[model samples]
Each structure stands twice: as C-alpha cells, then as structure tokens.
Target: MLIGVPAETMAGETRVAVTPETTKKLMAQGHSVRVQSGAGVAASVTDAAYQAAGADMTDAAGALGCDLVLKVRSPSALELTQMKPGAALVGMLNPFDAEGLQRLASARLTAFALEAAPRTTRAQSMDVLSSQANIAGYKAVIMAADRYQKFFPMLMTAAGTVKAARVVILGVGVAGLQAIATAKRLGAVIEASDVRPSVKEQVESLGAKFIDVPYETAEEKEAAEGVGGYARPMPQSWLDRQKLEVAKRVAQADVVISTALIPGRAAPVLITEEMVASMKPGSVIIDMAAGKGAVNADGSVGGNCPLTEADKTVVKHGVTLVGETNLAALVAADASALYARNVLDFLKLVLPKDAAGIEVPLDDDIVAACLMTQGGEIKKT
Candidate 1:
C-alpha cells in the first residue's frame, strides 16, 4: 500500500504527519510511502532523511493520490475533493465542523478520526491525544516561563534571596501532569488541582501541592473523570465554586496553566474575568483549550480561532493569555513519530489480509468506532 503524507496546510501548523523514522517502520512493514516535497522541513525532518528512509518525495497530487492518506488535521476542501473515491484518510478530524464534515461526506472516502479512537488498554500506544498532549503539556510550561517576568526556581545571590515562582496547574490529565512535572523541574513551587479524586496522588508525586475545594459530590467526581473518562463539562454550581476558590490562588501565582478539554466538545471556561483580574499584572495564563472556546474572562473569551497575530489581539485582563495553536509542532520530530505510530496501528487493524488491498470494513468495531462519515452519512454518537 502507498501511504501519502502531505504538508499540513493549517496556519501556524509546523508538524508533519509522518517522519523519516516512521517511514522506515512503514517500509519495514512492506508499505510504500510518498511525502509531499518539503513536508517534514518545518519539523526539522529533511527530505533527504525521508529518502534515506525509503520514502518517495513528490508533489501534493502524487502524494495525495495514494491508497491511503495520513494527515495532521483534515485537509482543505481542494485537497479532499481531489481524493479518489474509496481512498482512506485517517487523522485528527474535527467531526463536528459542519462544513468540513460536509466536504468529507461528498468525497465518499473512508475516513477515520484519530480523536475517536477507543480509550482501551490495547489502544494506548495508538492514542494521539496522549502522545500529542505530552508535548503540549511540556510546551505549556515553556510558554508560561517565557511570558513570566520572574524566575521559576528559587535563587540565592549576593544581592539577596529570590523566592521560587508559584505555579498552578488546572486539570491533571496527561498534559496537566506533564505541566506539573515540568514546572517542578524548573524549581517552581507548584500547586495542582483536578475535579477527579484519582489524580491527587499523581499531582503530589511530582512534589506539587494539590488544591481541594468544596463541591457537590456528584459534580466533583464526574467533572474530575470527565465524560466517558474523557474530560467533560462542569455544572454551573461547581464552576462557580471553582472560580471563587481558584481566584485567590491565581491572584498570587506567577504562572497558571489551564489544560482542561473535552473530546469532540467545547473546552470548559474554568477561569472567569474576576479570576484573571484578581491575578497580579504580568501573570501568565496558557489556555490549552483556547482553540475550543474554553478560555473566558469577564470581557474576553479564549478558544481556538482563525485569529492571526496581525489581528492586534489583546489579552486585556492584565494577564498574558496564550491559546496554543500547535504546541506539538514545537517539537516536530517526536510529534510526527507518535502521530505515525497511531496511523500505523490503525492501519494494521483496518487493512485487509492482502497487503495490496483493503476494503472499508464498515462492520468492524474499530472501523465503526473511528469512522465519522461514510457513503454520505455521518456516524456519530
């Protein structure tokens, strides 16, 4: 089978879908690969490296016109429209995007959403969320560090003793945990919180204090574990209590990182205007869910946007708010490697017995599970 890896067309996107390392693995499995010229350059993976790994470099048309297509995000309409009927596409497809969904249906392609991968033990290694979030979490801290005026670690100098920066992390998932660990490593006095009780130990293990506030038992536990063990929406009451409790801490912290998200749903607005205003000037807030409208303050809302820097954007609450667009792209090589692994694992399950051919197995659980649309129909829960 020929696997196509095209350059990511999304603005601010620098990560490639496939890397030389993964291309080598694919070739070892008897799969031929075609990467769009310069696809891996931004991620620092050279075309020469891909050639050495047994991948053929070509133009977008040649690459996209393959047996299977792998992408970082859904392709542009022009790209999707060019797909041959029955060609397979797998990636982090935003199933809820109405226009994109419609274009996908019109293509009559076998499409899989990596975000829809089942959360099971067998699927752990193939989990793009975990792999990508790991990098995102690490990058969030770096972004916070850059925005913050004060140093993270405590310092002793001839001038005087400088105290460590106080860092707070909200949401203790893979990204949250990574943020906690990264902040701690930088010598920050970190405090972490999550609605789920299961992560208290995980937070404390990283030498960060855990914040526990009062809330209704049902809402508390449910919000912590999130929906389907994925992040979920929080009730107004719990959110109200959280705003109050977290405001005081935010006011004092040097940096705050918000890593809350719900799969295929909008990100919850964990911080309000009061929360941002309460914080001292020069404090930083990295809203990981900003792309999903998850960041909101009294006057401003943060979520994913088509906004570019020239838009004269302002984080007005005296808080520097960064809505990370493609944090994983900051570390392209690893991101591509992990993304390819997920694509490869998924192919192994969906591919036909004959290496050269594969039928869209609509009846298969993994197929039905990840396939968002087929035959002009949307298969969604």
Candidate 2:
C-alpha cells in the first residue's frame, strides 16, 4: 500500500502528518510511503531524510493520490479534489465542524477522524488530541515564562532575594498537567484547579497544589468530566463560584495557564476582562483554549499565541494575554513524530492487504468510533 504524507496547509500549521522515523517503520512493513516535497521542512525534517527512509518525494497533487493519505489537518477542497474516490484519509478532520464533514462526504472517500478516536484501551495509542495536547501544555509554560517579566524560580542576587513565581494552571488535563510539571521544574510555586476532581492526584504528583471545587450534584460532576475528556459548559452558579475562587488565585499568581476546553462548544471564558484587570500588570496569562474563541477582551483569534495589535499595547493592568492556536506546531519535529506513530499504530489494525479484502466493517469499534460520515450520510451522534 502506498501511504501519502502531505504538507499541512492549515494557516499557521507547521507540523506534517508523517515523520521520517515513522516512514521508515512503514517501509520496513513493506508499505510504500510518499511524502510531498518539503512537507517536513518546517518540522526540520529534510526531503533527503524521507528519501533515506524509503519514502518517495513528490508534489502535493501526486502525494494525495496514494492508496492512503495521512494529514496533520483536513485538506482543502483543491487538495481533496486530487484524491481518488476510494482513497482512505486518516487525520484530525475536525469532525464537529459542519463544513469539514460536508467536504469529506462530498469527496466520497473513506475518512477517519483521529479527533474522534475513542478513549478505550485499544484506541489509546491513536489518540492524536492527547499526544498533541501534551506538547502544547509543556510549551505553554515556556511561552508564559518568556512573556513574564520575572524569573519563575526564586533567586538570591547581590541586590536581594526574589520570591518564587506563583503559577496557576486551569483545566488540569493532559496539557494542564504538563504545564504544572514544566512550571514546577522551573522552580515556580505551582498551583492548579479543574472542574474534574479526578486529576487532583495527577496535579499533586508533580508537587503542585491542587485547587478543587466540589460540586453539589451528580449531574454537575458528570458535566465536569466533559465529552471525550473535554470540559462542558458550567452553570451560572458554578461559574460565579469558580470566578470568585479563581480571582483570588489570579491576583496571587505571577503566571496563569488556562487549558480548559469543551468540545463542540465555545471555550468558556475562564478569565474575564475584569479579572484580567484585577491582576498585577506584569503577570502572564496563557490561554490554551484560545483556539476555540477569545478568552479575554481584545482577544485575537487564529494564532498559536495571538497578540493584540502592536500600537494598542494596553499595558495598563500589566497583564499579558496570550492566546496562541496550535501550540504543538511550535515543536513540530517532536509533534510530527508522536502524531505519525499514532496514525501508524491505528493503521496497523486496518490497512494494506487487510484493507484489500475487508469491506470496512462498520461494526468494528475503531471504525465505528471515528467514522463520522459514510455513504453520503452523517452518522447520528
């Protein structure tokens, strides 16, 4: 089977679908790999590296026509037009987005949305969202640290002793945990909070204090768990309580990294403009959920770290608002490697000769979990 790897076309996306290392593995399994020329360049992977791994380098159109296509994001209409009708596409197609679903269905191709990969044990290896979020979380801390005026760690200098920076992490999931760990590594006084109390242990494992807010009912608890482990919309009462607690913490923290997300829903505004105004001016707030929408007033959309206009640099409250989309792309090389491994592991169950004779068994859990649309019909949720 010839598997295609195309360069990411999504604006600001730097990661590619397949890395040279993963290409080598597929080739060793007797699978042919074709990579679009310069696909791995942003990730610092060279065309020569792909060639060395036994992957044929070609143009985007040519690569899209392979037996199977792996991509970092959904391909554009022009790119999809190049694919053969029966070709298989495996990638994070943003299934929740209506436009994305419509395009894939129109293509009449077998599409697997990695974003919909189930949380079951068998599907763990192919969980692209978790893998990417892990990197994003780690990098978010670094980004916050860079913007922060003071050092994360306390230090004794000739002048005086500086106190350790207070870091607050919201969301406490894969990304939030990683952020906590990274900040702690830098010697910051780390504290974290999440709607789900289950992650308290994970936050404390890295020596960060866990800020837990108990809910009154089972329904509230269930909603906190969120769809596919993402956060769900909270009630006004819950949000009010959360704001009161978070406001105190925000005022104390030198840095705040927010990673809370609710799938198929607008990102909840965990930090309000008034809250941002309450913080000391030099504090940094990194909003990981910025990919969905603005987390604060004057919020810029569509970047890994969206910044307000240069001239309008409202530095009054001394808070730095960071909303970067696609933080994983910042570490493209490592990100691509992890993503490629995820796709390869999943494909092992349903590709090559195995794909040849078997009509996509709709009953298969992996297939059922990720198949968003088939035979021109969108599967009911």
Candidate 3:
C-alpha cells in the first residue's frame, strides 16, 4: 500500500498531515509513504528529514495520485481531480458539509472525516477535535496575554503595586479548560462559565472561579447535563441568566477568551455588543469560535461575541477582539505532529498491518461514524 502526504492548499493552513516520525512508522508497517516537496515546510519539517526517514519526496500530483492520501484539510476541486477513483482519503473534513461529501462521493473516493469520530474512550487516541482544541485553548491565553496592555501577574515594584489581570473564559470545553489552566499559570485571576453544570468542579480544580448559573426548570437542567460529552443548547431562560452573570464579569475583566461552539450549529452568543461596551478600554478577547458562529447581514460570521470578525483582530467599543479561526495552525510543528499521530491511529482501524490493501471495518463505531463518502455514495449524513 502507498500513502501520500500532500501539502495543505488552504490559506492560513500551515500544518501538514504527516511528519517524518509517522512516515517511518507507516514504512515499518509495509507501506510506502510519499510526501510532497514542502508539505511540512510550514510545520518546520524538512524534505531531507522525510528522506532520511525513508519517505519518497514527490510533487503534488504524485502525492495526490496515491492509493491512500492523508490531508490536514479537505482537498480543493483542482486537487480532487488529480486523485484516482477508489482511492482512500483521510482528514479533518467537515462531516456536516453535505456539498463537500457529495463532491468526494462524486470523485468515487473513500473519505473519512476524522471530525465525526465518536467521543468514546476507545476513540480517544484518534480524537482530532480534542487534540486541536487543546492547542487552541493554550494559544488563546498566550495571544490574550500578548494583546493585553496590563500584566497578567500582579507586580509590587519600587513604584506602586499592580493588580493581577482578570480573565473570564466562556464555554468550559477542552479549549476553555485549557484557557483557564494557561491563564492560571500566568498568575491571572480567572473565571469560567458553561451550560454544563458538571464542569464546575473541573473549573474549580484548575484554581479558577466557575460562574454558576442555577438551572431554574427541568428542561434547563436536562440541557445543562448535555449530550455525548458535548454541551447542548441551553434554554433561552438559562441563557438570559448566564448573560447577566457574564456581563458583570466582562465589565470587570481585563481579558476574555470565548471558546463556546456547538457542532453543526451556530455558536451561541455569550458576549453581546453591550457586554463589549462595558469592558475596559484595553481589554482583550480571543474568540476561538470565530468563523463558526452566527452569519451576519454583512456576510461576516461572529463567535461568542457578535462584534467579533472572523480571522481579524479589531477594536470595537474599546475592546480588542482577536478572531483567529485556526489557532492550532499557529502552533504548526506540534499541531502537525499531534494531528499526524491521530491520522496514524485512525489508520490502524482501516489499514491492516499484514494486508497489502485497505479495509474499511464498518462494524467499528469510530470508523462507521467517520466514514463520510465510500463506494461512490455519501455514507454519513
């Protein structure tokens, strides 16, 4: 079996799908690996390094036209044309994009979108979302620290005493939890909020305050419990209450990092225009959910804050909003290494060690959930 690693064509995508470490591993398993020249350049991995690992350095066409192709992002129409029918593709393909899946199906390619993998213990090694989100969360704090004019830690110098920066993190998911931990390490006073009540302990354990909004109704409680390890949409009543609580914190906060996002749904607004207006003049916000949120009339999408512009950092109402969509890509080297390992782990389920051909085990829950387009048809809705 031959595997290809193509350079990511998406703008702002600096991470590659495979690294020299994974290349060697694949070769040891009786598979030949072909990596396009400059595929890992952005990730700081060199062609010489890949060659040393026994990988064939090839052109984009040579890499794309393989029996199995690994990618960081979905292929473009032009790149898709280079692939042969019945070839296998694996990537962080957006499973919710029906048109994209249709395109893969039309190409007669077997596509596996790793983003759709189940959040189970058995699938933890292949969980791309968690791995990427962890990087995003850490970077969010680092970016916030850089943008913030005030010091994160309190200072008592020969002059006067300086207060520690107050940071409020919205959506206590993997990213949010990481943000809290990073902020705490920087000596910032942190507070986090989420619809799921169960994360309060996790928040408190990280030495950050959890903004608790008691569920008033049964529906709110049920929603707060969440589904499948992800937070469900909270009732409007609960949201209103959370808004009021968050607004108070935002007013006093020096930095805000919002990571709230529901899969396949518009990100719920946690910080409103009014909330932004209330914040201090030099306050900074890292909207991790930017480009995945509500689409505005002006053809721009927002994150946890409606004022946030995707992939742009701007000051509106005296608040600096950092709307980077791909924070993990900013940390390219480690992100690529982790993502490549995830791709390798996922391949274990599809590619047998002893066999020369790939096999899709439909009975495997993770494989079944991730299988998007196979056999000239879309397998996942």
TM-score of each: 0.91, 0.91, 0.99
Best lDDT among the predictions, by candidate number:
3
Give the alpha carbon lDDT tens digit for every residue of 1-381 in model 3: 989999999999999999999999999999999999999999999999999999999999999999999999999999999999999999988998999989999999999999999899999999999999999999999999999998999999999999999999999999999999999999999999999989999999999999999988999999999888898998999888888999999999999999999998999888899899999899999999898889888888898888898899999998899999999999999999999999999999999889877798899999999999988999978
Evaluate candidate 3 by giving its C-alpha RMSD to the native, one decimal: 0.8
Candidate ranking under lDDT, highest first, comes to 3, 2, 1
Clashing pairs for predicted structure model 1, backbone only? 195-224, 196-224, 273-298, 290-303, 290-304, 291-303, 291-304, 292-304, 293-303
Q: What stretches of model 3 exceed 4 Å from their correct place? A: none
Indicate the residue-level lDDT of 288 in model 1.
76
Who wins the TM-score comparison? Answer: 3
Better of 1 and 3 by TM-score: 3
Minimum summed lDDT over a 10-residue window in model 2 is located at 302-311
Candidate 1: which stretches are off by over 4 Å?
A: 215-224, 294-301, 304-315, 359-364
Kindly list the per-residue Cα lDDT of model 1 for residues 1-381, writing each as its tens digit: 888998888887788888887888888878889999999898888899999999999999988888799998998988986678778888888867767777787887778888777777777777888999999999989988988888999999999999999998988999999999999999999988777777889899899998886667775666756554576666778777777777778788888888777665666666766677778888888877765663334434455321211213246567777776678888887888788787778777777445676565777666667887777766664
Name the weakest run of 10 consecutive residues (lDDT summed) in model 3. 352-361
